[model samples]
Target: MIELGKVEYYLLAINVIGAVVYLINMFLYRHTSNGQINVIVTITFLLGGSAGMLLMMLFFDRKAVKENMMSRVFVICIFIIQIIILLIYKGHHAEHVTFAFWKFFADHRMLLIYFGIMNLVTFIVFAIDKVNARAHRSRIRIVTLLGLLFAGGSIGGLISMYLFRHKTQKDYFTVGMPLIIIMQIVVIFYVMNAGW
Candidate 1:
């Protein structure tokens, strides 16, 4: 049997509660434009990926169901922006959010790599899905994005999804996202026990 540590336990508890809160908020405010608010976007930014897209959608253009020249440009721009934001993470205003927490957390660079890989994978998978046209293009891009996220690299995927609106909501996300978080906990357990 797996035992949860205090930190992992608290993290898990917070995630579950956050999900519930997001669900409740979605049901309550689904129709409202509250998602446009930066604070609201930031709060769920990592979990939902809305923060990045909120601005684009408000300022640039909406994502259409079909692919076109403009859609290609949009995807390209989103990916580039994700890369920029991630590369600039060290200098972000959020750095001061918790100078102390940085000491305990794993290397931010490794985590950033994890995120970048997930989003890149999501992009490839999404492209392949568009070509297949078999029971596809149902927002599972978000799932692939978040699945990779759960697998470790969620921050990158999270940011990508927000900008791309890849896997906003879907059955895959419902299951895979939580599993990713759980896997991280398992890895943490192993690391702590393996004489790290």
Candidate 2:
């Protein structure tokens, strides 16, 4: 069994809780004003979240996603479909509310910027770690990597992990990283629906 630290467990729990809560809220009367729209978004999240988590888990189990060209193409296709569906849903809903996108962006731009910067930094850190490993040099601290990933650099962290072929075998990155991404997505979903 892969032993996860307390923090990893906490993050995983938060991810499941957040997604479930957000999904429940989406079905409530107050939140489900746009019935069809809400259904689309809800389904997308349910499917996307489940698929994403499954893929990550598969990677954690050492399935060698990188080794098989066909598997890589299939996974990429699924990921692209998920992104497309999410974008379409967001764009559709944006049209209903006047300047919703702008308002949301304006209010949460700082957070978005922070997430973006942190992800980039985290990706660079992971890439550097991979280089160091290859060169047999000193390495970045595990705590530092975990800290960055928890602080909203998850998407970047995962991207770097896969891109650099670094840390993919570790339970922390494979499992914990997906959990973080799910939590972040839930938070973003909540903030978008929350009227300013």
Candidate 3:
């Protein structure tokens, strides 16, 4: 068995704390943007053992959703449909198809833990810039932030937006966020299987 040490013990405690905090924040997310993430989907994502999305919710100001009530309803409809499709896709190969994704993630828990840390560090840097970048504003510099925003840190970027009251705008999402989500998926998949 692996030996326990003070530093390792402390790190485990920190990770558990971080996971709980992120989970609490997730339920609070309902920004009037892309849509509220679906419950089944969010549960699957969480069970899939990835904490990145949960951490993302913690940083967004759900109240800033610009549209009115009807818009939210429309968004919700789309959101549910998208989630259903994602679930079917991820769980397609398993007997309990609805939960196939969860089993897969459990099998690759190491990669999920790795992904969680990657998101946390990137978000901290983004959060720092969210506080410091306003005065030095230039389109080019802003572009770079947007580019980084598209680099597997959508959750962090979203979190930074609300926590700093920064980058919560629509376009930052229309382009940057989706790209980052795609990139994150690709990276996670690579990391999950690259060495095996």
Candidate 4:
């Protein structure tokens, strides 16, 4: 088991506080401007670490996640910085650090499973939407499709779009799907290469 030191513990505490603040703002305060909220959230994310902020963005404020590209990029950058710090610390304490790609896979098996399931679901939803479109039935909402794509289903979404010949004309899907895929790929590569 990895033991967290004082700095890590303090960072965790700050992250928890930041998450609480984010929740309160999301649930109780409706008067704040989007820009103001973004600034506050970004600052907290930077100071406290990004895992909590990312979870909040993914689960609580997906609309902002979808719309605020700059904030998303900033959060991702913060996450990268956190990873770099971890790598540097591990380098200093090399005896305690044993990193490999397979080790990462083993450690994060559940996350991989979640992604796999999400991708399958995204594909099915896209297929259903296409069938509905052909049958002149109620169509799936674009937001739902985009949400799935954003939530670790970009690969499935891209395949479905091409296989089903659906939503190909929409610039958002054509552009955004690939962009998300690229971003995901870059992050994965960075993690895989960080120490392994």
Candidate 5:
């Protein structure tokens, strides 16, 4: 019989609460706008952690999930972070989980740095493109934007799209970016699981 600790209990409680909130919002507030509902669901997933994210994904409001790229990206990111933390906990069995996280961070410092730089560059490019669009100047190409997204900048691209309201209405952007993110997540999980 494995005794659960405070962290385990807390994770379980949050997941249960998040699922309840999701179901309540889904059934009782069916008329709410996707944006509003997404806000609530995103908050729920953030609080609920990985299990909550999985539950929401499993029992998602399909229309909402389809329409809201930013929310989807945000939820995926939260899920990835929580999963990484859980993996670190399991790997090190450290008394302090933070130590485990720090160790992992140290081990993957270069990869993290690369992602940080790529995201920053992508964000700046998106901002520049938005400015260009506003000023009637030459703009970045769609191919370039998609390329950046493919190169570990999907998070930055999605965030910039939301913040700058650039290309938000375009089907390619609305659909493509999330798909890229999901692919990236899959590749990452595969690489990690493969011990590469």
Candidate 6:
């Protein structure tokens, strides 16, 4: 049996609860505004990804993750699922929103700006960690990195990982970061599909 830490449990609780509420809002309000649906979907995937990450951490053995080809297939499947969800939402709501996805995104410029800022911050943190590592100074904690990733910085974190060669060796960074990206991608698509 896999044991989850207190923090992990708390995160899981938040994800599950938030996802439920978002789903409820999606269904209960049949005539929900585009903006409201966008926000709800954003929150849903953000929490859903966080929860998925926690579940993976609790149940996935590090050795298996590191060595197994099947695990890679699983990750790809998850990514595909996220993409399909986005496509479905977009297809269903396109008539309700902009004629094109690009215009839909333009309508939600503020969400993109927020994501840009978070990614920038995440990138800077990784850069700072790299510098500190080279200088032989105290390192930034993994928890902080993970927190930023959870808080909408997966893209930045992944870029930093490859760009700075930081945290690449760790199982969490390689595996968990992609999972975070999957969720973030869902959020991005949710905004793109936001009915307006």
Supply the TM-score for candidate 1.
Answer: 0.30
On residues 1-196, what C-alpha lDDT tens digit does candidate 6 reach at each position? 9898775575567666654554454344445544345455345445444334334434542333233322333343354555456456446444453336467457768777888899999999999999999999998877688778878788999999999999888777787788777766665565565553
TM-score comparison, 3 vs 5, better candidate = 5
- TM-score versus the correct structure, for each prediction: 0.30, 0.46, 0.37, 0.49, 0.48, 0.50
Give lDDT tens digits, candidate 1, residues 1-196: 9887674464455445444443444344445655524344335434334323443443444433222222222323333344334334424333223333234355546754665676577556654544444545453443344445545554444445446555456434434444444545444433333322
lDDT of each: 0.43, 0.60, 0.48, 0.72, 0.70, 0.63
User: Backbone clashes in each candidate structure, one number apiece?
Assistant: 4, 0, 2, 0, 0, 0
Local lDDT at 142 for model 6: 75
**lDDT accuracy of residue 58 in candidate 1:** 36
Candidate 6's TM-score: 0.50
Better of 4 and 5 by lDDT: 4
lDDT of 4 by residue, 1-196 (tens): 9998987897788778677767765664455554245567757777855777777768877774333544555565566566566656656333343436567667889878888998999999999999999999999988788778878898889899999999898766777777667667656655665544
- Model 2 reaches what TM-score against the true structure? 0.46
What does the lDDT come to for candidate 2? 0.60
The number of the candidate with the highest TM-score is 6
Regions of model 3 farther than 4 Å from truth: 1-100, 135-151, 178-196
Please give, for residues 88-158, the per-residue lDDT of candidate 5 as tens digits. Answer: 56663333323243455467899778888989999999999999999999989775887789789989989
Best-fitting candidate, scored by lDDT: 4
Model 5 ranges off by over 4 Å = 1-105
In candidate 2, where is summed lDDT lowest over 10 consecutive residues? 65-74
Question: For all the candidates, what are their Cα RMSDs to the real structure?
Answer: 14.7, 16.1, 17.2, 7.3, 8.6, 15.9
